[model samples]
Target chain A: MKAVTYQGKKKVEVKEVGDAKLIKRDDMLVRVTSTAICGSDLHIYHGLIPGMYDDYVIGHEPMGIVEETGPDVTRVKKGDRVIIPFNVACGECFFCTNQMESQCDNANDAKDTGGYFGYSETYGGYMGGQAELLRVPFGNFVPFKVPEDAEVEDEKILFLSDILPTAYWGVDNAGVKPGDTVIILGCGPVGLLTQ
Target chain B: MDYRLEHAKRTNHVETYNFEKTHDIDQTLLEATKGGADVVIDCVGLDAKRTAMEKVETALMLQGGSLGAFNTAANVVRKFGTIQVIGVYGLKYNMFPFGHLFERNVQVKMGQAPVIHYMPELFRQIQTGKIDPTDIITHRLHISDAPRAYEIFDNKDESCIKVVLKP
Candidate 1:
C-alpha cells in the first residue's frame, strides 16, 4: 500500500509500504477513506520531532470503513464506518475512565505520554493513517462509530479525529463563555476552529 | 498573504489580525482589549515565528521552538486571566516566563487535547450543522502528492489552510 513517509526536513513522500495487519486481539484495520495533514504534522515534516526516521508514516486525522477487526473487538466490527481518534487508549485505564484518554497509562511504553498515531516514537511508534489502511489498537475504545446513516460525508466528520475536538477542548479549558473577549494567537487550523 | 486571517474573519466572523504585521502585539492587544483580553489561546506553539536569538537557541538545542506566542500570551492576558495552549510544545525553554505569569496570578492549561473525550459532543455538533470542520479545507489532493502538499501547507502557499489526502 502507498503511504506518506517522512523523508527529512520539509519533506514527505508517497511510498509503497507493507500492508497494515491486525496484530493484537483488539486491533482493527481501517481502509482509509479520507485523511488530513494536521498543523502538528508540519512539526514532523520540519524535522523537529525526535524519533522520526526516514520513511516514518505521518498522519493522524483519518476516517474510513473498518475492513477487518481482531477476534476480541466488540465495540465495532467489520464494515463499520468509524473515525479513529489519534490517541491509542485502553478504555479501562484510570485516565481513560476519568475522561483523559490522551494520557492513558497503557498506550505508550516508550514514554509516560499517551499513545498517538503516526507521531514520533515519543508518543508511540505506531504507523500513521496517511495510507490505504491503518492498524488501530484498543478497538473497544479508539474507533469512534460514525452514524450508520448514509447522509454524512467523510469530510464533515474527519476533523472530529483531532482539530474539532482540540479546538473545543481549548475553549473549554480556558473557561471561555459567551460574550467574553478571547484572543486566539494562531490562525492555523486548530486556532481557526477554536474561533 | 493574509489569507488565514481573512478566512477567520469571513468564515468564522471573528475580528482577527496578523501579529507579525503589528509593531508590538503586546501593546496593540493590551490597548485594544482595555488592558488585556480575558483569555488568550496560544495555538501557534513551537512553530511560531522565531527571532534571530531564538533561532540560534533552538538550533543549538538550548531551547525548544519559539516561545513568541507563549510570551505574547503572558504579556497580553489580563491580570488573573486565563491562557490556554492548544499548540504542541516540546522539551524546555531557556527563558520561560514563569515569574511574570506567577506575578499576575494567571491561570494556564495545556496538553494534548484528549480528543476521544469530546468526540460525542463534537460529532453531534457536526450532525446538527452547528459547526463545519470541512470549511477549513482549502486543498484536496491525492496521496501521491504528499510532498507538494507538505510543502504547500508548511509554506502556506496557494492560500492553503488545510489539505486532505485520499489514497
Candidate 2:
C-alpha cells in the first residue's frame, strides 16, 4: 500500500509500504478515501517529536470505507463508511467510559498517556492513516460511522478526527459558561475551530 | 481579523486584538475586559510570540519551544478565572509563572479534545451553517504536494492560515 513515511529529520516521502491488515480480533481494515495534514503532523515533520521510527505511515485524521472487519468488529462492518479518530482506544477502559479516550489506559506505550496514530513512541506507536489503507486496532471504539447519503464534502467533516473536536474539548473542559468572555489565544486550526 | 476572529464574530459575541499593535498585550487585555478577560485561553501554546532573548536562543537551536502564551494567559486572566489551553505544547516549560497562578486563584484546563465525542454535534453544526470550518482554509492541494504544502504553511507564506491535502 502507498503511504507517507518519515525519511529523516524534517523529511518525508510518499511511497509504497506494506499493506495494512486486521491484526487482532477487534481490528478492522479501512480503505482510506480522505485524509488531512494536521498541525500535530508538523511536529513530526519538524523533528520536534522524538522517537519516530522511519517509514511509519504518518497521518491521524482520516475517514474511509471499511475494507474488512474482524469477527469481533461489531460496531461497524465491511463496507461501512467511518471516521477514524486519532486516539486509538479500547471502549471498555475506565477512561473511555468516562469519555476521556485520549487517556485510555490500554493504548499507551509508557505508563499513562494513551495511544495515538503516527505520533512518537510516547503515545502507543499505532501506524498513521496517510495511506491507501489503515489497520485500526480497538476499531470498534474509535471508528465512527458516517452516513453514505450525507450531502457534505469530506473536507467539511475530516477535521472531526482531530482539530474541530480538540477545539470543542477546550471549550467543554474549560467549563465555559454562558456570556463568559473567553479569550482563545491562538488563531490556528484548533484555536479557530474551538467554540 | 484573522480567520478565527472573523468566524467567531458571526457565531458569538466576541472582540479580538492583535498583540502586534500593542506594546504590552497583557495590559491591553486587562483593560479591555474592564479588569481582565474572565477566561483567557491559550491557543498558541509554544508558538506564542517570543522576546528578543528567547528568539535568539530559539534561532540558535537552544530551545524546543516557548511557553510565551501561557505566561500571557496567566497574566491576563481575571482573578479566580479559568485558563484553557488548546494549543499544542511539545514538552516541559521553563520560566513559567507558577507563583502568580496560585496567588490569583486561576484554574487552568488543557488537553486533547475528545474528537469523537464532539464529532456528531460539530458535524451537524457544519451541515446546518451554524459553524463553517472551511472559512479558515486558504489552500487545497493534492496529496502529492504534501511537501510543498508543509513548506508553505510552515513558512506562513501566501496568507496561508490552513492547507487541506486531498488524499
Candidate 3:
C-alpha cells in the first residue's frame, strides 16, 4: 500500500509499504477514503517529536470503509463507513473503563504510554492513516460508525476523529462559562476550534 | 494603536501598545481603561517581542486601576490581581518580581488543556453549526505541499493563518 513515511526533519515521502492486516481477533481492516493532516503531524515532520522510526506511516485522523474485520469484531463489518479514533485503546484496561482511553495501559504497553495511531514515541507508536488502508486494533472500541445522514459533509465528519474533541476539551479545561471572555493564544486548528 | 492590535480590534476589543511610540506604559493603560477594566485578558504568549510589550501593558493596566489577567505566564500579572496562563511555553520560564507577587497577594493559575474531556459537548456544537472552525483555515494544499505549508506557517506570513492538507 502507498503510505506517507516520515524521513526526517522537513522531509517525507509516499512510499510502498507492507499491507496492513488484522493481527488479533479484535482487529479490523479499513480502506481509507479520506485523511487529514494535523498540527501534531507537523511535530513529527519538524522532528520536534523524537523516536519516530523510519518508514512509519504518518496520519491519524481518517475516515474509511471497513474492508474486513475479525470474528470478534462485532462493532462494525464489511462496507461499514467509519471514523478511526486516533487512540487505539483496549476497552477493558484500567484506563479505558475509567474513560481515560488515551492513557489505556494495554494500548501502547511496550512504549511505556498509551499508544496512539500515527504519533511518535512519546505517544504509543501505532501506525497512522496517511495511507491506502489501516489495520485498526480493538476496532470495536475505536471505530465510530458514521450515521447515514451525517455523511453530508465529509470534512466535518473527518474532524470527529480528533480536532473537534480536542478543541472542546480546551474550552472545557479553560472553564469557559456563559459570556465569559476567553482568548486563545494560537489560532491554529485547535485554537480556532476552541474559540 | 499597534497595527496588529488594531487588526485584532475588528473582531475583538483590543488596545494596542507600540513601545516605540510610547514610554509611559502606565499612562497608556490609564487611557484605555477609564478608571480600570474589570478584567484584562492577555492573548499574547511567549513571542519575546510581544511578551515584553505585554508585560509593560499588564503592569500599566493594573496600575491604571484595573484587575489584569496575565494570560501569558503566571508571574507576569500585577500583585493582588489574577493571572490565568493559557499559552503553552516550550522552554522553562522564569518569573519576574517574585517578591512583589508575594507581597501583593496575587493569584496564579496555569496548566495543560485537557482536550479529550470536552469532546462530547464540542462535537455537538460543531455538528449543529454553532461554530465553524474551518473559517480559520486560510490555506488548503495537497499533502505533497506540506513542506511549503510548514515554511509559510513558521515564517508567520500575514497571508497564512491555518493550512489544511488533503491526502
In terms of lDDT, the best-performing candidate is: 1
lDDT of 2 at A9: 71
**Whole-model alpha-carbon lDDT for candidate 3:** 0.62
Candidate 3 residue A62 Cα shift, in angstroms, is: 2.0
| Residue-by-residue lDDT tens digits, candidate 2, A56-170 | 7788988888999999888888898888899888988888998888888899866488788878677887888888899999877889888778877777777788887787778
State the lDDT at A169 in candidate 1.
Answer: 92
Residue B94, candidate 3: C-alpha displacement in angstroms: 7.7
**TM-score per candidate, in order?**
0.98, 0.92, 0.71
A62-126 in candidate 3: lDDT tens per residue?
87889999999988989988878777778887777776776778877566567788887656667
Better of 1 and 3 by DockQ: 1
Q: What is the TM-score of chain A in candidate 3?
A: 0.94
What TM-score does model 1 achieve against the real structure?
A: 0.98
Q: Which is the winner by TM-score between candidate 1 and candidate 3?
A: 1
Which residue pairs overlap in candidate 1's backbone? none
As for TM-score, the candidate ahead, 2 or 3, is 2
Q: Which candidate model has the greater TM-score, 1 or 2?
A: 1
The count of backbone overlaps in candidate 2 is: 0
Worst 10 residues of 3 chain A by lDDT: A179-188
Give the DockQ ranking, best first: 1, 2, 3
Give the poorly placed runs of model 3, Cα more than 4 Å off. A110-112, B1-71, B75-123, B144-158
Residue-wise C-alpha lDDT for candidate 2, range B36-98, written one tens digit per residue: 878877878667767887777665666647778888899889999999987888566557788
TM-score of 3: 0.71
